[model samples]
Target chain A: MSDKTSRRTPGPVYVGLDMGSSRSKVVVIDEAGKLLGHAVKKSGTDFSRTAKACLDSALEMAGAEFDDIAGAMSTGYGRSNVGFVTEESKTEIGCLAKGGYHHFPEAITIIDIGGQDNKIIKLDAAGHRLNFKMNRKCAAGTGAFLEEMSARLDVSLEEMNHLARDAREMIKLGSYCTVFSATEVLESIRNGKNVNDIVKGIFYSMIRRVLEMDSLTERVVMTGGVVAHNAYLVEMVDEMIGRPVLLAEYPQLMGAVGAALYARDENQSAGATTAQASSKGE
Target chain B: MAAGKSTTRKKIQATDLMNQVMSDYFYHLNEAATSGKQKVAWCTSVGPAELLRALGFAVHFPENHAAMLGATRMSTELIPEANSAGYSPDICSYLTADIGAWMKNITPLSKAYPGIESVPKPDVLVYNTNQCRDVQDWFSWYSKELGVPAIGISSPKNVVEVTEGHIDDVARQIEALIPTLEAISGNKLDMQRLRETVTLSRECSELWKKVLETATATPAPLTFFDGTIHMGPAVCLRGTQEAIDYYRVLLAELQGRVEAGVAAVDDESLRIYWEGMPVWGRLRQNSDLFAGLRTSVLASTYCSSWIFPSFDADNPIRSMAKAYLELFIVRSDAYKERYIKGMLEKYRIDGIIYHDAKTCPYNSNSRYGLPQRVEADTGIPCLVLSGDLNDLRCVSDEQTKTNIEAFVEQLQERQ
Candidate 1:
């Protein structure tokens, strides 16, 4: 409730803000890389305001003040707009790879289906990125696609997921384009196709789209707000990939977590450099 | 790899002379078009320009003009005019933009040169399909519209090895064009003149190759962006002494930079090989983006397409046929892979970026699993960027910037 600049605390905490297109998420972590608190809010037209609000709520939960923050990093579509980040904003691909590796600590492929884009990042055992791919200049495999299909199906996003789970026979939509698939959904409704089946088909279409973007590694970790809300999609991906996949503790907050980890790592390295310089002077 | 410190790129002094050279070249073409004293021949960028020169004709390249339209950002507006006239949007934007500009009675040339109303009107339009069949269709459309004789050589496609048979076929085709060229120019083909022109072209190509090879030095003297611009002489004035002379100047400037340790991109820690057509509309933006990231795009398949190692003045016709046939665009995937691998090693390239040009499928090499194969064989990473050579509508600036940044970060991590 207090102004951020006026508050003071005793210890240092790192901050990571994933200012994505659909949502702004902030994670507060201690010096030991342990998550202290996190917050997520809708990222409307004004990204800067949303980022501040998420940071305030997250800091409040962590019982920390502005003076306690050691370093900060930002990622995602709105990263550049976040004025408070101390480090150069990283790409969502790098943040995702770092966050995913923190969880598994091994060679893993991170699939992040976000609001307007989807990413598949591959990282080695040492947390170095091997390769990464983002969906081409189309909205087909992202959360935006699901929202459009849900709107056409006359259901809320949550209702669509629930309906998908209830379907006995999955209806397959033929078109990959979000607009064309809406028309196909209308045609299915005209042909007396089951609504639940149609909803399941939409989920299947989204999963299929991401699958075609790139081949997956053996250890696949699913993250992002889409999978966080629509758990059925994760199950579908598992079924499709023919293996169990790891899910981050907070799927939508993984990029923020990754950004926080970067802040911590960078701060420690700077401290080591300063210590070495001072010791040499002595 | 730590990020390189940002510094202003060293300007190549030859650009001033290149500007004058280009202005004079266009001035002569306009003079020929307006004065009606000499015949003006429209040739493809990689067509037999030496032969055209020997036959006593002033040359104009539409591909060069289309690139100007693209660089000046005029193609996006004019392309619709051609699309409205039934040219598919999926074909080469170079063809569509050129035809579209012609339909609109506009050109980037008019603005660059005072008193020039449009591109030089052709007395004869010649094409070589070694690049693509689209050039033949493009030239044919203009031929029908202007009632000019359109002559072309149907060079073999997906050529793996340029056999003597292929050379003979193309040689006879070149020989076949003489009658029409003589009729149009009101001059006969002079073998001695042709041989002289071929010699000039050979010298010019070697100098251009040396200019590009200067990037093999640490902290490369020039970037691929520089090559794309400085290549103007090599592409448009290949058969003339002016081109040979201009390259000698450019080569010396580059060599001076290399000796003095001046780099085109400051702190050039990462060296990259660009594997497809330059995103013509976004050249400055892309160039600055890479420079800011401290990555030097030192080599590319597109700019090197003009290098004709096969040109031999002693056997001008057959060697010209061999040179034209051995073009990189016409080569098979296996041969292309080998060529790219060699370039990566030659340039000490740390990474490769393939621009999957939407309209230029012939030049876009990323679609056939070439990127993965190269990465696998060479242990160098590759990034595929989806864009077009001339169509700005197909390119996503924000997406491309993010991809390049991430690719640089990935490479840095490996280091």
Candidate 2:
């Protein structure tokens, strides 16, 4: 009885804590399936401390405290760390399914990019995702390279988008490493080629990885922090995937929202089952 | 290392080196059986240690024996046992050695040498699943060959420990194992003893997890690889007081180092993942190259294979039984993502150097675009350094070095 009391009783409100390879992520959702409020914060280098900070910040942004939250969940590389979060914490699959379903009920593919991994999930019309393909281990065409190359180019992310969108010709930089990309970018600048061309090449390379999905159907839902920041990447992915990439209104908040949705479902089911059992005259 | 001979004539030379181990083995076996103190050992996938100590009514592990054949300097000779058994030479060397040992029926009954002919043989066999699927195939053969019951802990694909349902599965497996365990130890299935063992092992494993993460902070207490081997005493001889003591010392060393801010590598310029298995022949040199860069493999899919948290203690038996379902190497795509995210979070890995192990299909075969995927998801740059995991002849030491040097330069540039 004490254990039951100590453990969180299923309640309304859910949160998503995406423990990423490069960063941490969080989101919140209220009961009746409403997005009360959401926030995005950088994940930490040290998970225990970093995740704690990310969680705290998200809670503050939601205009509440951690105690105010009725339930919580986490996903990403850091899900295990969130094992202590709640019993209802779902895997990235269920979160993405929930978020993607909420965003585009017809969405079939859900793509998420974090600091160090990328995934192309295939969802059904109900946003019920099927088997998905992911490339979290490899970094050839991921956001890390883009961020690295952007740093090397000494161009701000905003400038990168502006320049990439305006590039005259996309030079096949063929530079896989950000180190090599930097060298190539610098050399191209030294050789009097526009830095924008190299930046375009870098974005295209990352897009190539995302577009490699075998069954990338229409209604693709894109999530993760980078999705909101890099429109060029989204646009390129859209063109490359051969479909207008769907966006969650709060792409970064999807994981958290999904998590909160899970929490709400847990409470709803618990309440319904208990109501039925009590009504049965027990 | 002394070249201990195959035949009896060289026994004298081998005497001084292994006399202590042989003496202890015999003494413990006789004393335990006579005193009716049953000893069982848990298995770690990477080394021979834990299972070796558990022999004689205690469980024995072929996995560690296989690791010895893969990683030891003398891997060349002992490893062929796998190839002789028709296993691919390019497979995990440990599996080869394990398969070879199992096929030979070299249990506790098998005499260690002519000197200690009285060494009691291992009565029960235990196996650990590697992140590689081959572990399942390898152990299936062991089960068939030994005819003695073989207990296996299946690795899972899903990471969430939501329900205690896994405990139910674990309990079922443990229930089946009781009769075999009883038969081997010549003791009845004592429920109290099982509970004690489970409680102690769970405590020990939890400590190990704490110790592993303790090294992640600045001046990391130890490299993930060292911890992988050091974990030997716990996973192998767990369910005993010794395991508790061993962890205390190890944890103390780790905590001391943490307090002192003793970085595992003094000048770690970068931390990289060794994508595939090390080319067995060039293990030292390849490791050295990284050490030069202060880029220790803080966590790797391969090295972290043994570091899984068996936290679902509500049911210890099935938890142990279902343990394999979580091996990062063997899990499905979704499972791999979960592990990747955890690794990046648990260990402060800056960059990754993906090594496509030369002939190890199991180690090498992964999602083709994972490097990019990882980079995008984590925002860390990855250098896809194409090198085979184990074919020494094909990999060029110099070329690999140049690539590593360049990769480190990228990390340094970021700093």
DockQ of model 1, rounded to 2 decimals: 0.49
Range of the 10 consecutive residues with the lowest summed lDDT in candidate 1 chain A:
A1-10
Q: How well is each residue in A1-282 modelled by candidate 2, as lDDT tens digits?
A: 011112232334567676666667776566776665454555565665776776666555555556667767666555657655553334564566677777677847788775665666666554544444445335666667667777777887667787888888886766555566667777887888887787788778777666764556667778876787778778987787677887867777676677667676766788899999999987
Docking class of 2: incorrect
Question: What DockQ number belongs to candidate 2?
Answer: 0.01
User: lDDT tens string, model 1, A48-159?
Assistant: 8998899888888788888789989998888888876553688888888888888889988899999989998888888888888888888998999998988887889878
Alpha-carbon local distance difference test for all models: 0.90, 0.58
Give the poorly placed runs of model 2, Cα more than 4 Å off. A1-282, B1-56, B99-121, B128-133, B136-167, B273-283, B301-314, B318-330, B354-365, B383-400
- Residue A88, candidate 2: Cα error in Å is 57
| iRMS values for every prediction | 3.2, 19.7
Residue runs of model 1 more than 4 Å from their true location after superposition: A1-10, B1-7
For candidate 1, list the clashing residue pairs, or say none.
Answer: none
